[model samples]
Target: MNAWICNSSDGSLISFYLMGMPFLPKSLFLPVFFIFLILYLFVITGNSLILVAVVIDSNLLKPMYFFLTNLLVLDILFTTTTIPRMLSYFLLGDQILSFPACFLQMYLFHGLSCGEAFILVVMAYDRYEAICHPLHYTVRMTPQVNIKLAAGAWLAALLIPIPAVVQSSQMAFGTMTQVVNFFCDHLAVVQASCSDSTFQTFLGFCCAMTVSFLPLLLVVLSYAHILVSILKINSKEGRSKAFSICTSHLLVVGTYYTSIIVAYVAYRADLPVDFHIMGNVVFAILTPVANPLIYTLRNKDVKAVISKFMSHWSRGYP
Candidate 1:
């Protein structure tokens, strides 16, 4: 019932059928739907609480929390872009996406994923500045500079995927091409194309590598300086305070890269298609879920603010 096309633009059937997590059996869809629905709720609720706390509490109005606000926004958008659609597919069999819609999802997924990495790097740089150059930190990390840094990270990330998405859009596709992943992931879409995918594949790898390791490299360098500065501090308490400042960010960075590496290995290994799909799914959900947890549990200031807010709300204070 689906039409095939020699060219992407000429197709009468301009839709994609998403096979949301092909690993699971149909009978299990209900349970899986419930599970992911809970996660989606957690992602929203946890990140929203932190965002609200940062906004309302004058204590959190700093360069660090400002960057955290950007990361929280990205986490919310990133999961929203994929999880709700995934939930629909699980619960209602709403798997089919129109051509434009599919590409848009793919673009947003990759762009926001890249944005998170850049923001983490920015956060690391903020830590480096605060620790390594405490006296000059206020002057260097002014509001204008922080704004520019956040804007640049987001702009560069959002722009980087344009060429790849545009090229992928031009590739040949069959009628109702079946995307093997839950969402319109870049690699999954490319593999579904009828056109030769070698160039696209390579381009994707190059972009992924650059996005993954380059920011990672920057984060490492920043921490290297942070470590040296921490050691140079004379008092034990001072050293401990400096190290504690970075622990939350470090945990987040570790979790983000670990998920990516797992996903990359799963994709590259001689594994089943389901493994690849699940890998990407984990990559999609894991970081966002872990980010809010890491910040709240590990960062004292954020935790304190969130606790105070909760108590105030429980008291029914306006």
Candidate 2:
């Protein structure tokens, strides 16, 4: 047990002590703080730029960019939910999170994560339609339909984790308040509970499958259809163009799942607790940081728009 956990005479919980980068020496905390600070700033600035580009350019008023904007908003919220507190932990050595604040963090992080997964699925479906059924793509993915799809994803994400969070909140904390990670990750908080956590663990697993793998499966199926359609194109240039359209989204998907797998493996493998902590940290930070970079580099349209936006801003245009 960590030295921070202590007995409560009345068996009630008041706060949680976050163990931020337990493996790092005290002298290195400031450096890690600065590193995370930079990444968080990048995530905010990069995603915000993409969002602004999509908003200002009438050319980007389509289903794909709409979903892209949704994704950018989710990524921004996702990082905001965890990284600021983490920076405080690293910089000021303030690891104490009030009880309600800890659960709120867990709920917001998990909810935004779920929203991003589903938004990716929607993007894949949009790509599939554009590639496999180009004639009907516009009719099928109209603005109202896109609005409904995005709203449904956000609503499901907001509601799906309520049960697990409520159940976990009711579990007996009883002074076992040392959350093993820098953030209030679902499993870490459940484990901190002094009460029975087997059911909570299982519940978290089920929710993970529902939100994570289910969306991934949908994306894979959509891409499979897209691949079949692209293969039917007679001209090599046509095929290349079709595949290029998906490259950025595919890269985003790959980065997202790679971080997830890394975190999952670090937890399930026989590794040190520090590795487990770091794995979750990677999951929290990696995709949001990489997502804008991938889209900006891989998608010519986005790159051009961002470039134009930057030039206009430099010349004092609103």
Candidate 3:
């Protein structure tokens, strides 16, 4: 009886229950748990490596790398907020959450998530400056400016979710205790509340559109200019070199935006529970997994830094 209301019989509005991926078959538990355990390790290791590489490698300390480091930190935090609890659900069947903790989790997860969206835009702006306004790139995107931008992204994202959290905190809980998705995700919590969620839904919709989708649109607009600038390069090699830098970021942005959109749709629409659960998993789990790999594979500098670190480690061990 994971349901937590003052009176479950009438199901008024006191508490709620969590139905974390309820449709997941028992037969898939061990496999899914094992997979997520490995996935979590990969996320931590991968994102940590990106952060460390940017920190230790002086040559990698461009304005873009500054943003990359921030992105890595957000990725680490974003995955950390959800993945372990998901793992616990698979291994130990612990989906129960107190009202406070549940809402808190929702806040943190969406806050970090929204932070990542803005960081991606900042990263796009970094490239835009380097590509379009090469002469002023340094003057414009100085270390101090980069710090301010990163701080702004975090502050803006964290604050945007506050209204949702505050409203939900005051709302009465109805009979709908079971959250459809795993972990206490933002929309999941709001949808499960027995009380009317119109205000919060509108708030979240506006936030997603303005905070998330707007940044994505800016990224696309920036890259459109970048592509035009790259095409103007007379030498094919120069154009190729310039375009190569954006591929990883574009790929990451594509994956993240697509995952979130699909996931959100699944959650909102009358879709199957499996699609909803897997949709959450896609953006939450796979994006972190793909991020470091995309950067390391597509960018020579990251690969070089990784190789250097690995070589040093091997030498010490040898």
Candidate 4:
């Protein structure tokens, strides 16, 4: 809870220039703004519908939907932290974000992202229990148990980014407050710090990788077990059906991790800053949309329940 000391009057510790696509010509700003706005709308609307459908459809009351509901909320919040302010910058051309606001944005973005990773790992466990240990799935994934898992994910996400944010907040900026990135990302923000942020940057990187990929490792392990079990099934139909349940989730996971890898690689490489920003913007906007889209198209159970829910809602609409 650091107080913002961005004294615009003194002009010393003022706002930082969020370098959003420096080469992007002014003429294309409107088009780009609308594009991002539409994608943001899609992210919000699509995730919201899935959230509502899961809540209303009694068929979806299982542990899978319980975890999905948490995912949707995380997706919504993840973008909600940055998109509005970004849209404002696009609309008003005010790319200057106060120091405190920038840090808050960074904290929320990293925290929610870490939380989503953890949730996906938990979902992998859910799928493992359902497919590999069906007889014990009931006892393993009770509603109360799912609630606890979701709560733990949220708590961990909220708490894990604190050290990073605190260190960033305490950093002193030099006369040059212009950050060469769209938002106050960890790398971009630290670059502008006047202090020796080597330790802070290292800590953030280690924690981020650990938080993001440790769960990914668990997901892979769970899926490996799932694959073994599926292969062991004697009936072809049983194998197909069992594998189907995992496909949608695997697709979403692939896209999510691919985006993460690409963005990190682009950011770390000596490529143009535009490349890095575009990689982050495109994927960040697309991730929330990915989950609901995959769920709707790949998961028969979700589509069936959603279709039924839509029909019922339409009939009741004035």
Clash totals for all candidate models: 0, 0, 2, 0
List model 1 lDDT by residue over 130-162, tens digit each: 999999999999999999999999999899999
Overall lDDT per candidate, in order of appearance: 0.92, 0.90, 0.82, 0.83
Residue 313 displacement in candidate 1 (angstroms): 0.3
Cα lDDT of model 2 by residue, 7-98, tens digit = 45242455888887677899988888899999999999999999999999999998999999999999999999999998998788889888
Candidate 4 residue-wise lDDT, 1-318, digit = tens = 113432243233557778688898989888978987988898898889888888877888999889988999999998898788778878899887876678888898888988889889888999999999999999989988999999998999899998888877777774337777677788778766766778887887798789878889999999999999999999999999998988988987887898788877887899987998877775566678688899999999889878887888889952
- Candidate 4: lDDT over CA atoms? 0.83
Worst 10 residues of 3 by lDDT: 6-15
TM for candidate 2 is 0.96
User: What TM-score quantifies how close candidate 1 is to the native fold?
Assistant: 0.97
Q: Which model scores highest in lDDT?
A: 1
State the lDDT at 80 in candidate 3. Answer: 90
TM-score of each: 0.97, 0.96, 0.92, 0.92
**Runs in model 4 lying further than 4 Å from the true structure:** 1-14
